[model samples]
Target chain A: MIQRRHALTVRVTHWINAVALILLLMSGLQIFNAHPSLYWGPSSYTGAGPIFELAGGFPSWLTIPGTQWLAMGRRWHFFFAWILVINGLAYLIFSIATHHVTRDLAPTRSDWRSIGRSIADHLRLRHPQGEAATRYNVLQKLSYIAVIFVLLPLMVLTGWSMSPRLDSVWPGWVDIFGGRQSARTLHFVIAWLLVLFFFIHVFEVIVTGFWNNLRSMITGRYRIEHEQR
Target chain B: MASGGVLLSACDAASRNPHVTKVLSIGEFLSQHVQHAVTSRTALAQEFTEADLSPEFRSNGTDYPDSAEYRALAMNGFVDWRLRVDGLVERPVELSLDQLRAMRSRTQITRHDCVEGWSAIGKWTGTPLSEVLALVHPLADARYVMFYSADPMDDWGTRYYESIDMEDAYHPQTILAYALNDATLPIPNGAPLRLRLERQLGYKMAKYLMHIELVDSFARIHGGKGGYWEDEGYEWYAGI
Candidate 1:
């Protein structure tokens, strides 16, 4: 039962992705305050809600005196977006060039059945691995593949739907996505999925064995416990 | 990571070589152009609550004009500033701030999106662009209206300038903003005159009013595109 661990490159990429995503989400929330409601909702509403208010709904700290809430949000959002983009691109390019994305994360054809079995084992509906599979035990490969290929790419495309270009060059895209307003709504929903993914990934790591996983990622090695048959 | 992906795709979409694409390709232009109304109807959206506005909207590009002409106008409180509404118009009027203020007004609370991927909602008060256009009476040849501002970019030795098409020119929310938050537009915020085209991003809203030229096409205009960013890598039709 020789156990392998995350490589240094994978460890760095994971942490970079984690930090960039957090900043992007926080700043993105500020940007969304401009038009709060999901576009598909009642047309009666457009641009509602407080981006930031005092504890008592009072203005006591660093108030600009006579500025609008949306304006301030714009400043923060624009500045933070630069950080998120540069950081994210670095990690993405590095992962691809290093073959981490293609090699370790992507799922194979057999992963279809193994993923279901792995889920059963994780939930304790079945015993741990039968000492048969090498590398990722199906569930890891499936989740990683889904995140890298499906969710992240969807997030990028839906985000671009907000651009004015969506109307001019690709009215077809707008039609396919229902409409521009609907695309904005989808972007918000997908962002929530990313937020959920972050928490669950972290919580699962802790539950499985926090110190072990953390150290393996950081140091790139883990002790193997071999049970002699 | 998600937001990063968003920025990447957006830049990819915005990518273009300014030289070859003299004007934003209609197909590429419309891809991002905010399709306000299929018909050529111009109207203003609803006004916004004071609470809905952002606290600090940072100024981008040139904050103040350096040209002697603009400096003199600003020094005189822009009372003498004349926004020449000429070219392809029936009246070819030269309007004063006082005259503009006297006209029928349209107030709208709309989101101001920036190319940098940030947005803000603010209440803008001004005459509907169409109202001003009516006085000019665009000629049958006029297919685009170019906005020339006093904000100088001083490219090498020449000055910087920008323009827009008729579609954006007549958007319901498009206005020659003179007031912000119910006060005289501040200098830093393009006082005396600035555009508030709600659908397009902030860069398209050229500040420091000077002239509005009605044109048949953008071919002869500076760079032959629309906006300064369009002369660079940005898509001229930045509708969001």
Candidate 2:
């Protein structure tokens, strides 16, 4: 039996986010390469220098222009940032309006109880099959919820916190994250966390039937191996 | 891109896609309009105390302008230097360094955020630009104030320049800084005068000042883009 996995909206938004995030990351690196350093506290120069100062910033191929071009890099970063925000907002609205959150995303009491079993199964590369395979597992729900809800929004806020004009409109708001530099640090850290999630996500996709997962995302069809319940 | 060389041939041959850039510019357009609309008229950039000042104020791009005109003025301690205020103004004024110093001043300690994502805080003391505007009353048609700097950005003698709208022109924190860290503004830091556009990125702060031209539009200016960097494809609005 072929399970209808992802909704059309989910598939569309997921691809949009994929492209937007990749461009954002690349262009972000190009911007980072300008100063090639990260700091803590309210400012970069505390007489202590930066904690995460890179002599030569992120290399080419990782950066959008594949060379240092802060001006062009900024253009690309801000452009895709709007794409990310718009797509994410659309996804959020759909999730809420359709009760997709409660139906699929929110972890259940049973999922909480099955944590140990889920961990064991994951460690052994033994994924659920047949009827169970149709739904998201406990770990999948948790990671997706965390990334979509917590990390993405925080990154956006931190990004805004760095803007001087925004800081003027609401002074001391950035102080919540320690300061602009500290907010900047948090932003960079969150970006890496997202990258880590991406790698793990791709790895999981490969392990749990690559083509099955890929097809499910692209065509919303995942063929469950066994016909019997 | 300030000093970052475009090293790859791909940057020119492949990545200089006009359609891609045009599409990207819509992002710039939206950001400028949205941010400008939302920003309050009374909103002021954050100011800090003496304790927040950087131990050593660092500068990028043309610390000490090596131009013959700038060098001559510096040699005479800027006594001969004059800040030309002309263009769309009723009274074209050429105020000397001493005259500018005699004017009412406002000093503030603020962060200088570079487009490259680094920031440094410094104390700046200078004549508020509103005071200058009063002296040379801008014409009703004037929309932008062009700042001509002493530092030449290119071998072809294209000097550094910047411009701002009248809203910023009168912002209290927006000043023509002649001093940094309570000392005479260092040569590398724009010397006789520099713009302190507190709400924008550092590039918007033109240094080593020479003239102030109030214009209805900057279309007739070099490259007709308003600023030296703007011509090079950077956004005219650097508030973000």
Candidate 3:
């Protein structure tokens, strides 16, 4: 019996990050009073554009109906942003110091094949390949890599696009996103994508064997059937 | 539903996309409810210490409205122009710039987050909107207030108007502003008169304001959507 791995710091960080992302998303939606329209295809909402008024001090009565809640939403968002940033930095520092990031998150050659097989198996498109699965399956590695590298960085960059100072400090970032308005739109769309990713991830876990997958994340060890090998 | 009542057909278009529209409507409703509960007809938009204030607060939309009449008012120190308050009020009144200046005022330092994804912080000073509304004596049926501007915005030619429910109207921080950063309102900043509905997105604070009308509802307004952007599918209530 390969003993189950004990709870590790990365697991804690991952769960914390997941929770923080949820809060960030909910608060962000509340603040997204600028353009509330959603389109199905190529047609878009014009209110998606930008309107620059440096320091807002308008009578609430002058506003349309939904903006008042956004006021409180913005306050929570600012405070929560600081928490997320600090938490992320701390996770990064700890991961680097412990070499956990390189050892665990880095993909091996065999991982690509196994991950692909796992995806096929999960979709019921292929039979499970016989192999002695180690700590994490192939799908887990890919998801982890994408979340850490692609989604996390995109979120941070897009979030910063809203800063007026960003244009002065990192003109390149604003330019990369086309313009501030485009960046804002991208930020919101990406946020929605992440939310979609989160739901799918949770659903997959439940479908695959909720207790088995969940326990591994919590206790750091999952059982594999001897016959599968 | 009545013929002369606020026309609500545009709202029928808005209702077609209900999920988005519902969220937008809820925001507007909440602002009104909160504004009504607050004392002094104003609520402080969030406040900030000196450290939070940005070095520059970029102006948006029209820094200075291009209308010739408004330019004349600006050139002459805005002494002649008056802010009119009528519509659903029992006592219609007009206030000169000086009289508005003499009223009690508040100064706040807050952040302005633009829809275009940029933000800045600045200090603003203005008379509470509650004080001005009080002068007109809003009737009991007046559930919403409308703001009309002299500036023509985009294709929404001639008038720039916005309406909010009474609750937000009474927020303590809600103001009919005449100053920015301790100076008289700049021409580009809706000088001589502008509204600062703190707690909303930037566009809600329409500048170069001309009239305030009290109404039972917003359905009869142009496009029947409460604001220029609202007419064009932007969320009617841009709170935060």
Candidate 4:
């Protein structure tokens, strides 16, 4: 039987987030192409070797402008960044107020105990079926929690730390991240982690009935299959 | 159809790329408004300690002015060089390095964040730009403080220049730095003088400073955008 799964707010925020994240990632790559290097301390320059450096610019297809245009890249990045931040804030506040976090995303004691078994099942490509598929599994809940609470906040903080204007108001942010360059390095590394998560997330959706899963997200109606025990 | 006509009329080829200009304008507007709303106009950029200074503050942009006139001044230790402060001022003044040094000076260690994703901390000593502005007394209508550098940015002899809003120009941290790292400013790092606008990106801090112009608008300046980089599509407000 099919029932309402995602709320309207969730569905709307999800799509907005999808668009914003894609734009952010693409424009961010374009911005990265300007320097293509990351450092650990307060300073980095010609003589000072960077902790990480890309050999060359990303391909045109990968960037926002599809060209080596730094100013344009920055425009796209900042534009979408505001959208991402606002949408994320609204989603976070709404989710917490609605008890979405407590009801679905929070890990229970038994869920914690089942984490090892869940990991093994995931490794073996053993996915939830029938009624089990109706609700999010323990691993899904934990990943969502980590991404929503930890990674997203880190990204926002690191982004803020890079802004000279923001730094003037809150100087300690730069120190907390070790330095501006360190904060930048962390921002890049965490972005890749999110990218990895996105890929895995998509793969999981494809494996577990792509249309049904995607349709549920879009239309807020999910069909729960009944299995004969 | 009416909206389309208006959109078509608004589009200009030289000013922006039609494909991305809409989003760019929105972003610029949002950034300006949000930053101004959230941050105090007089907020001081983060200052570092002597211990926090980088062993080597790598200089970005033009290290030395290539002009023969500038070279002649450099050879004589810039003693002949005079920074002209003119335009929209009650009293125009030409200040030598010695005269600038003689005035009330301030020293602070601050981090320089470049647009190219690098940062360096260095100690700077110089006369507060506010004092210089006071000496000249900028006109009430002067909205921007334009800085002219001796360095030629292109083959056309167009000098590198930058400008800041009157509020930023009067900020306590804004100064014309003459000494770096407890010594005379090096040639490779804007010798004689440079503008230290710590609240903005490195590019906004014009080096090899030669002239300071108080202007009501930047529309008549080179490229009419208020900066060498800003003329070439970089944001005029480099607060980020």
Where model 2 places Cα greater than 4 Å from the true spot, the runs are A227-229, B1-14
- Tens-place lDDT per residue, model 3, B1-240, is 253122222322333555645554554455434434442333244465566455555778877776788889888888889999999888998899888878898887655656533555567888888998888888899998889998877664657888877877887767888877777878777877787776666777888888999998888788898987677666565542
Off by over 4 Å in 1: A1-117, A120-161, A164-229, B1-30, B33-47, B155-157
Error of 3 at A70 (Å): 17
Q: What is the lDDT of residue A108 in candidate 3?
A: 77
Cα lDDT tens digits for candidate 2, B65-113? 9789889999989989999999999999999989999999999999999
Candidate 3 per-residue lDDT over residues A23-69, each given as its tens digit: 56755765554445332211122223233332343333222222445
Identify the leading candidate in terms of DockQ.
Answer: 2
- Residue A183, candidate 1: Cα error in Å is 10
Interface RMSD of each: 12.6, 3.9, 14.4, 5.9
Which CAPRI quality tier does the interface of model 4 achieve?
A: acceptable
True interface contacts reproduced by each model, as a fraction?
0.08, 0.64, 0.00, 0.48
By lDDT, the candidates rank as 2, 4, 3, 1
Write down the RMSD of all candidates, one decimal each.
11.7, 3.5, 13.6, 4.8
What tens-digit string does per-residue lDDT give for candidate 2 at A1-229? 7889999999999999998897789789888888888898788887988989878888776787876778888888888898899899999999999999999999999999999999999999998988788899999999999999999999999988888888887777888999999999999999999999999899999999999999999999999888453
Comparing 1 with 4 on lDDT, the higher-scoring candidate is 4
Worst 10 residues of 2 chain B by lDDT: B3-12
Which DockQ value does candidate 3 get? 0.04
Error of 3 at A205 (Å): 12
Using lDDT as the yardstick, the better of models 2 and 3 is: 2
TM-score of chain A of each: 0.71, 0.97, 0.74, 0.96
Candidate 1, residues B1-240: lDDT per residue as tens digits? 565566544422332333323332433434432244332234333334565566655566677877888888888999999899999888999999999999988776655656544445566789878899988889888988778888767655344455677877777677898988778888778878888875566788888878888888777777776766666545565554
